[model samples]
Target: MADFKELSRLLEEILEQGPAGCGCAVARNGEILFEEYHGVKDLESGEPITADSVYRQYSTTKVAVCTGAMMLLERGKFLLNDPIYEYFPEWKDTMVAQPEEDGSYRVRPAKRPILIRDCFSMAMGIGYGGTDYTHQAAEKVRAQLRANVGEYTLQQEIKAMAEVPVAFDPGTHWLYGFGHELVAGLIEVVSGKGVGQFLKEELFEPLDMKNTGYHYFGDIRERMVTTYLLKEDGSREASPYFQRDELFEPEAKYEGGGAGLFSTVRDYLALTQMLACGGEYQGRKIMGRKTIDLMRCNQLNEQQLKEFRNPYLEGYGYGCGVRTLMDPSAGVNSSVGEFGWTGMLGSYVSIDPAEKLSLVYMHNLFPNREAYIHPRIRNIVYGVL
Candidate 1:
């Protein structure tokens, strides 16, 4: 067992110096080493955060959704190179890339078809932010989708997605937005079930992740943390998008694959543990070892990895999740080959296969203060080990 006192101390200093709420958990080789929580869930109500507290996982949900998709892949339901249009006819030869101005450069048909591997590589032609021509075109399509369809449902949203122009040819460059959600939709189409239903049957049930799902309900609402956003003055405000009681409701406004799902630290740890164990947990084989191997291996080439690099991610590659490609020599103390991702609300999970280690941090505060906390937490834990 590893001593996590240093990890706890770092987390404490982070809370004292930064925000007022935080939670963290550390697990290794399928066993939890330590878990901690600090501060209030609701400042006004004085509700304290605990191990069971659930928070919106944002993009962290991508890993779960991707894992679920991989299970289907292992079962031989679909091949990685299979054209995405085969699953959804509407996607067939439907992608068109908008080009730079001047009649010489204009929109063109995709050279290759969108495939399952493209989704994993985030090269499926969708992005959240940019001012480039492709990004501008994608944004316009998103706007049109929202305008035509008032909600982001699977059927409705996918129809709208089909209408959007491709930002690049399939399997070309990486862009992160809506690709995972589209994967969820495709799962629904292929499995003849809803995304939530498929996950429940294929993942949550097998892993005994009782509190993990697309939406919380009934008594689970009591343990749900209120989402927050950072105000201009550095104060936190409740997010307008997530109401205090929305978790209890059965009908959700949208099935957001990219930025949805609420889970407790322990629940998410179970999912990550499964990955660390090469897709088996508690004697059940959720996915074959080979499939898990594919997920952890670098899916992007050096050039593609360079294109997706951002300030937040230095030497990294897109594995099933964010993967550190280089050692922490330049900065970032995490081990090379570490793979994981963070949520918009300060939640994070990372798996160091080399060390047989995993770390999970869950929080509800926004304008995420991860930069201040992640390094300290890594240093403390790595130092002890």
Candidate 2:
């Protein structure tokens, strides 16, 4: 049992410090045990955060995207050990990016090929596509996206990834980058459908997640909460929603698998609940129980785990695409096999399989203060449970 009153008070404190508004929900055994919204969706108009309010999921989108990919794996559509080159031949001879002392970078032929499993585990050395030579290559794709808009297709940009040298050899060290984007590309190729369309058909539709997708639908955009930037002084300024994040494009290819999803607390709960229930929603099996187990198993070695260090992820291991709890004291509510991911904008999704419990916490704040906020929410949720 949970003390809903205490939970509400704690969430109120969250709005006092971070995002202008937020929404959260928790479910156990397919029943929502706790659900609530706090603060205003927009500070100016005073629009309230509601169950239907949509949010840009950012990297949190990986959970659902990975689930869809794992579905294909469960069906034997692809094998984890298969090299990515098998699907994208351009990746056949990828190179490594080695930074020189002179502040420049050089390329070295990769020691091994990127396997499908590497993408799932973030061991493909893809740097979130922003800083390094390889990331710059990814940035070039986005630059083109900004310039030409719809002209730069997801496949075209993903294929162009081969031209960039990876930060490290695939399967060597874990680097959080565009590996999942590549996974999304793989999903597209394997399904013979666009990534967005494939998820709509395979996961969203089956779960009746009508409010979740990569773009605006019906009133989704209209119902979105305002994004806020939290200043060092602990004040929040309402910023434009979704524009800086490049979200809510109705006709977008949504190439980034690690980010670019729009969903609500209720809509995404459908996903976490299904995962918590071992891939079953209602009576239908979205995926095999064993596959879900495999997805939560720790996939990193001792050295790779070092590269995955962060405050919020202290006690977790990188599995499939979610953080698998290895040591509960590291920061989980209270389960060994708990797993899920976070969006860049302060949102978190946690699924604890032992108790068939899951939680979705949503807020849109820049410099999300994930280290301070996420653990508090996790503790409260688990403490009450």
Candidate 3:
């Protein structure tokens, strides 16, 4: 058991350091030993956050989607090296990046096909659609995505995305955002079910994650916390609440696999616990030990590793859904061999397999102004261990 008072104090400090509205939980070996919530769920309504408060998980959704894919892989549904175009034929003979006359690169035919492993590596053409050659192509698709102007099917969104050119050759580098969405689409194709239905059948229902899903509904909607974005002046801006009535509409239907899904701390901890125990929880095997081993192993070469590293992640290698390389002296103070991912909305979950510990910190706030809390919380948890 953990020192409850110490953990509580740390949680209190974290809440004090940031905005009052936040939820956090820590679990070990499938048991939630410490959990806490502070401030309001909805600032306007003054609704307090609870253990059941569900927040938009953003990129943390990648872990769940990746787990879904890995479960199918363990079942021999597909192989990692298989060409993705084999599953989504529309992606075959896609375009690559080439320099235009003005020194800006434009999309042309790809020399090779995008593969299944490329989806896992986030090498697929999807990205943040920012001002880069890759995102330039992504931006064109984004405009089309926004222009649909009505209820759009997932297939339509994917097809529109398919028309966009890839940023780089598959397997050349890691670019986050699109691979998980492609994986979600692949799940639909292979399972003969919608991504939501397939996840409910294979994961949510099986794991008894009653409160978790792609969209908020019923009583779950009431528990959903409003997301926030911190401004440069340190003020908080509230995000629009996701409404079931408005779902399937163009803006909402995008349902990005990489950064969509809302979950509670309790619910997400169950997931990490399952991973920590080598793919078993409460005698249920979501994946085999060997499959879990493969997911956690470093998949990137040294050169690939260099390309994947960034300000948020330094000295890390892409595993299935988590980041796995560890350099203790890299100055992050996180454990070596720890694997986990963070959400854009101030949510983080990491499993330290070496220490048999997992930490989950979630907040609905965006533009995580006080970014120090994540590392500090990790340090506290590691110190206690």
The candidate that wins on TM-score is: 2
Per residue, candidate 2 scores C-alpha lDDT tens digits across 223-270 of: 877788888898877777543545467665445688878889998898
Supply candidate 3's per-residue lDDT for 276: 77
Off by over 4 Å in 3: 1-6, 100-102, 145-149, 241-254, 332-335
Each candidate structure's TM-score, on Cα atoms with residue i matched to residue i, is 0.89, 0.94, 0.90
Best of the candidates, lDDT: 2
lDDT of 3 by residue, 33-150 (tens): 6788878777689888888887777788888888888889988889988987788877777787765789788667876788888788777656666676767767677677778655
Write down the worst ten-residue block by lDDT for model 2.
241-250
- Candidate 1 versus truth, CA RMSD in Å, comes to 2.9
Q: Which ranges in model 1 have alpha carbons more than 4 Å from their true place?
A: 1-3, 101-105, 129-152, 242-248, 321-335
Task: Give the per-residue Cα lDDT of candidate 3 at 238.
Answer: 73
Report, for every candidate in turn, its global Cα lDDT versus the true structure.
Answer: 0.74, 0.85, 0.74
C-alpha-based local distance difference test score of model 3: 0.74
Ranking by lDDT: 2, 1, 3
1: Cα error in model 1, Å: 15
